[model samples]
Target: MTGNGRRGRRILAAAVVAAALAGVLSGCGGPDDVSTATGSTQPAATQPSATAPVAANPEGTNAPLPEGAAVAPSPTGEPAPEQCSNPTASLRPFPDGAPESPALDRIRARGRLVVGLDTGSNLFSFRDPITGSIEGFDADIAREVARDLLGDPNLAEFRILSSADRIPALQDRLVDVVVNTVTVNCERREQVDFSTVYFEAQQRILVAQGSGIHGVADLAGRRVCTVAGSTSLTHLQRAEPDAIVLTVPSWSDCLVVLQQGQVDAVSSDDSLLAGLASQDPYLQIVGDSLSPEPYGIGINKYDPDLVRLVNASLERMRQDGTWSRIYDRWLGILGPSPGPPVPHYQD
Candidate 1:
């Protein structure tokens, strides 16, 4: 009977070890699978409970939304869209994805071209302590657009905005053009029009000095920092599913997370990473770009007349030395700006 008891105890020990091994394997989720969604309240970065994105206007494009339609933001995240005055010669009660006059026409009639831009962005737009005016390569281009349309560079109205709200502002006829390092993508084009590709880059990694996250493979079991509602989170999910991702509102917030030792790295477009690298000498951008991102000016699709006017103005900026000048002033350190690509409309 004692011999039987010893054998039974050994069998129980073996079973316990096997169960532990299975748990470890399950966490890794195989080689190409990245499903980290557990019972935890975190629902994928962009699809936030608070900041639910409204379906893009699909009436004229993918999902029709009346141009300038009242956008009811999700109760969980962003505030409602701000009320902005409609552009001149606007015919309908709503944006209907169509406007009558060119942006040039409106500028001439209104006596100024109002540009919606971020006053907080680096190299693109930021307030100058000495001049107390917004400045950046993006500001320079906006000035020139105002110059071309209204014959006075000083005739520019600059309205500061957050990253998530720029597209909505354009759709609502709030700004003539946006020059704050806006990335161009397929889904975005369906809702709004885009200028020619002025900047080309890839997503990269930002790490604290000496933490030693060499590449994506090194992120396993570590926490990564990313901007919420941006491509960085999606890429990290696909590449290092085993790692934890902390989504913040902006890349600046990602820096805050990395500094606090909450995350191992911050991944974003190289241009923005370069901005962070310039600001914090203790941080560095690591590894090659994970994906290509092109920057463009976002315009209202309902304002095709405005689109044409802006495109012509951008072409002029490219031809004359305005684009080069602004790029050199703000982002020359990133590398020379890429050649302009002709605008290709996809409806």
Candidate 2:
């Protein structure tokens, strides 16, 4: 059985035992003597029952929330659709699949593909406790890209990045590629290049179970937490203007705030929110996605060759069933596989 399942069963059994003890305590008459009758007739107020998640901030806070935590940019009208204009947009991988290029040359000389990704994102690209190695859907995909480039899957370095750092990492040449769960949009494309969409997910709400909240519409005047620099924040601001949006540096922070009752709900792509929920069974995702998020690898705007190579890697993964295997490993618990997203190239 999975660790989560075992933990859940333990919590369930503890709850049953607690309830039984409470019942037994209630049945016992406290000192059925005249002295007790004169003291008080009403039973003492029962302390609030404890549950699986008894602490508000189990993960703890890193730093105080940023200033203007509730403030967000006003909607700039509906987002414009993205367009691709690079020379390699319409190009295909080399005849051999692994093409020779300066991009490939730099990576081979360096001996490792520096990949920017999130270590805190649970199922996407997190470090496993047992192996102490970062492995997840995105991490696995990045490794495949590295193996194709350098001929060794482990010849890759994972650089942790926050939501805001993805484009900057590529623009500054700090990393050759970013496999973080970055969404593709026209504005972002202007800053960094992107491979074809590898995974498509939709925005949704995550809340502690039994919160009585259903979806985005129910967030009016409620405290909602989302990572700063994420599109989910913008959608939340526009969809529920009255809601108090709390911005944090990472999604893990949002989870901390939500657990502490500092936020009524957390919002993000379902793929990401699923990771959060899996960590704590008390939490659950609610409502439909606020918008579609097409995840793409962030490549340097100047490195179209690398972009093409990464796309080639993705194409092979899809055709060879590697993509589905990764999905089953990390994301199958969410639901049955939906298959890989079709690649779209615009010249």
Candidate 3:
């Protein structure tokens, strides 16, 4: 065939092939199918209708828990005090020079403080989406410890930990210190030492606004959520034996379940619940405190000197108004600074 004739035939063949391909694509979905940018077609019904009212529970049932979320086993009995008289008291601050210890020496040699915390914790320690940097009350406290130890706050390395992992991380020496919102108790003192109480929180309940679940009294027969391995769980079980308790990996998970209608309420520290409630205007914290929750920095039990050093830094922060500044910056939603908790020292 002549060159022009061959080119014409080739164009005709290409047109036929394109038409066949189009026919096959159109056959794959119904008329209601929507074309996606990736060349895939999805049922238009999957797309939410503009006029369809959103259901609180879309599946007509409780939403599935997030991965790793679990229902806590029923409490066997009230937990014993383990002979702890004053869990809030901690080692005295180091006098003046802040003498060095093996733990401090190791951290100095490493040149940075390895601090463990939960980035999922909203007001305490969470990541900033825009900045991609961790910013919260606990993060700042960890930085202060780094500043006192390494002479630079930026030298601190943050390690994200789960609620159940905080104690193990410290016990295993995985992190130099844990600035997570850990309650100091005699049971915990057995495994790790703690800095003096940095923040005093009170346990409370968070529920949907006007849920008629005013307090712990209303929690009976209702599903409540809290983080696993938390003091909140213990207190909750004791406060209301009839309530169904669901435990998740983080407080954020509790927020998720609450929003999905999987649970009626979330029980935790008022400080933590404030963070959750702030994220969703439909939620509110209700009722008086269930119990006092004294937060302390977790240090390995073997590191008494490091504990003293951390306590010293906390003392300086309290006196210099750094604590108040941090509180006002992150927790102003909870109200005015209660002024940093009075430090109790065991001389």
The local distance difference test score of each candidate is 0.59, 0.72, 0.78
Two-way TM-score contest, 1 vs 2, winner: 2
The better-scoring model by lDDT among 1 and 3 is 3
Output candidate 2 Cα RMSD. Answer: 17.8
Candidate 3 lands at a TM-score of: 0.82
Q: Which candidate is the best by lDDT?
A: 3
Highest TM-score model number: 3
Candidate 1, residue 306: how far the Cα is off, in Å: 1.5
Quote model 1's TM-score: 0.66
* lDDT (Cα, tens digit) per residue for candidate 3, span 131-189: 66787999999899999988999888877677777898888888889999999888898
Q: What is the lDDT of residue 16 in candidate 3?
A: 39
> Model 2, 1-347: lDDT tens per residue?
56466445544543533332222212212111111011122321222222212222213443334222333433344654555553224235445766667888888888989888766688997766666678789989999998888888887787767677677778887788989899887778778888888999999999999999998888865667887678888777667655556666568778877877767799999999999998898999999778888898889988878888888898899999999999999998789989998876774
Off by over 4 Å in 2: 1-91
How many clashing residue pairs are found in candidate 3?
Answer: 0
How does candidate 2 score on lDDT? 0.72
lDDT at 3 for candidate 3?
48
lDDT per residue as tens, model 1, 52-147: 222221122333211111211112223333422321111112123223455546767778767766543566666665656777777777777677
TM-score of each: 0.66, 0.77, 0.82
| Model 3 C-alpha lDDT versus the unseen true structure | 0.78
